[model samples]
Target: MEQDLLPKLKETSVLIMDNATFHKGKRLQELIRCAGHYIVWLPKYSPDLNPIEKMWSRVKMIRNKFRVKDIDKLFKDYCNDLFGI
Candidate 1:
């Protein structure tokens, strides 16, 4: 999933993430670090402070609209469209 995002990132970016176990994997950390983007872990229970939360809402709405069987691909494509990635 992080691999898909690499193409969308700017030379310098700050990736704000929640404290999900999958989000903190060593491989993903290394990927972001190598890409020269820093990670900022958002505090628990502060979805209001995160722009991705809003993005997720938008994505979910689109997902529900399409009723896709392959949600992962749909999400990536939808995000790419939404953000012009």
Candidate 2:
């Protein structure tokens, strides 16, 4: 993730994520700092600060509209329903 985002990040860029165990390491910190970016970890128990949480809520509501269990069919259905294709 760091490798891909590093080239695209410029000065004053910030990356945001929750304080999960997988998000930390000395190497990762060095890499981010070298790229002139910053990390802003979300506060504990603050779901409102996470925008992706709201997107997931909308996705779960859409999931209820589909009954198909087949992965391939579900992929096509999801694209069609979401994109009107």
Candidate 3:
């Protein structure tokens, strides 16, 4: 985030993120604040409020259907199929 996303921000912004353990780190919060942005944690267990949750659910379903063994390849293929990336 610091190396890529943060430096591209054109102005101060509010970052809404899920309550992932890594996201709550003191150093991460400090880095965001130091960049003149604010952090807002999503409510716990509120999957409907997080758009990524829907995508993750779909990914999980697809993985189960395909019985994928290689996650890195699955993710790459899925992204390429879904977003032409």
Top model by lDDT, which number? 3
Residues 30-66, model 1: lDDT tens digits = 9888889999999888989887789888878878877
| TM-score against truth, every candidate | 0.56, 0.64, 0.82
Off by over 4 Å in 1: 54-85
Q: Give lDDT tens digits, candidate 2, residues 10-37.
A: 6678889777677787788778877788
**Model 3, 68: alpha-carbon shift in Å?**
2.7
lDDT per residue for candidate 3 within 8-61, as digits (tens), equals: 998999999999999989999999999999999999999999999989988987
Q: How accurate locally is residue 71 in candidate 2, as Cα lDDT from 0 to 100?
A: 66
Q: What is the C-alpha RMSD of each candidate to the true structure, in Å?
A: 5.5, 3.2, 2.3
Clashes of each: 0, 0, 0
Of the two candidates 1 and 2, the one with more favorable TM-score, higher being better, is 2
List runs of model 2 lying over 4 Å from the truth. Answer: 60-79
Candidate 3 clashing pairs, residues 3+ apart or interchain: none
